[model samples]
Target: MAKLYVIGIGPGRRENMTLRAINALIKSEVIVGYTPYIEYLEELVEGKEIISTGMKGEIERCKLAIESVREGKNTSIVSTGDAGLYGMAGPILELAKDIEVEIVPGVTAAFSAAGELGSPIMHDFCSISLSDLLTPWSLIEKRIENAAAADFVITIYNPRSKGRKKHIEKAVEIMLKYKSPSTPVGIVKNSGRDGQEQIITTLGNIDYKKIDMLCVLIIGNSMTYIENDHMITPRGYDL
Candidate 1:
């Protein structure tokens, strides 16, 4: 039976990827993904049929992967974070026909960024992407407002891009209506990959200029705090 593996590469680092992800890649006769994510596979995808596309080519990649699988080639389509979370898994499953599809989970940016910035996600949390390309900005704003009102620690993805610079600021504005100005916010760039950088700042003090699309921001809830430069959201454990 032809099979398609929807795999998550995990923060663009080989070590961060799950062993199953690696094995899936090895078993695949063809590799498909966004261009940058394909590079992260490095030598693992060597000698395989590589189908890569630039940003916003997600549907194309999914179609190509399905085509490859239908042609009797075991194919692996990769996404940076857990494929299920704002990754390739959703579309692949939605567009796929009868081909066998397996979703291989990997460490998402939130968890990777959280590990680098202490434990800001130790409590209840929700992730929201600031990119309004496919989603409407009004919807994004409403989600941000609800997450803030619910006091859920928020992990923001696609916080900033060349054209979407003001979205993060708008999100912060919505959050400010409910969260305190002193709420801990951890920003991590490049996450578990090379050139990783992280900083624990406050909701009132985010240097928006320092953020980019590669960055993930974890905004702490009311119970969250910064101690010893690490963002910590207590899980209610007794001392």
Candidate 2:
């Protein structure tokens, strides 16, 4: 049967990609993804029929991938981090009709950043994207407030960009209403990939200017703390 595999490439590195993701790419005849993400596939997609689009071309990419599957070709659409999280998986499934579709989950940025930041997300958490392109700013604000109020360790994605400079700042302001200003916050950029950078600080002291779309912010819960330069959110364990 013709199949469309929505694969998460995981931080654009072969080592970070799961074996199943690699096998899915190997089995696929057509590779579709954002241009940068396609580059991350590197040699793995060599000699395959490739389809790439630039930013704001997500719907087009999904249609192209679905078309390839309809033509009886095994196609794979790639997403950096987990395909299911703010990636191609949702669009592919929404637009695909009468086609076999499989979601190959890969490590998300939250997990990758957590690893680099020393387990800041050891407890329950929620991911919130600060971008208001598809979602309303009001809705995003409500979610942020709720997440903070619930005391879920929060992992933030797409925290800042050129046009949306104040989004993260506003989010932090909302979080401060519920969380302590001294709550540990870990920022990781290019997590699990080359040129990775990280910062361990508190909610009151974050250098918002240093954060960008490529970075992920892990805001620790009440029980979270920074110990020996590593962010740790204990899981209620007692020595």
Predicted candidate 1 versus true structure: per-residue lDDT over 1-239, tens digit per residue: 87999998899988999999999999999999989889998999999999999989999999999999999999999999899999989999899968899999999999999998898999889899998988999999999999999999999999999999999999999999999999999999999998999888999999999999989999999999889888899999998
As a TM-score, model 2 comes out at 0.98
Tell me the whole-model lDDT of each prediction, alpha carbons only: 0.94, 0.94
- Candidate 1 regions exceeding 4 Å error are none
What is candidate 2's local distance difference test score?
0.94
Give me the displacement of residue 172 in model 2, in angstroms. Answer: 0.4
After superposing all C-alphas onto the true structure, candidate 1 shows an RMSD in angstroms of 0.8
The C-alpha TM-scores of every prediction are 0.98, 0.98
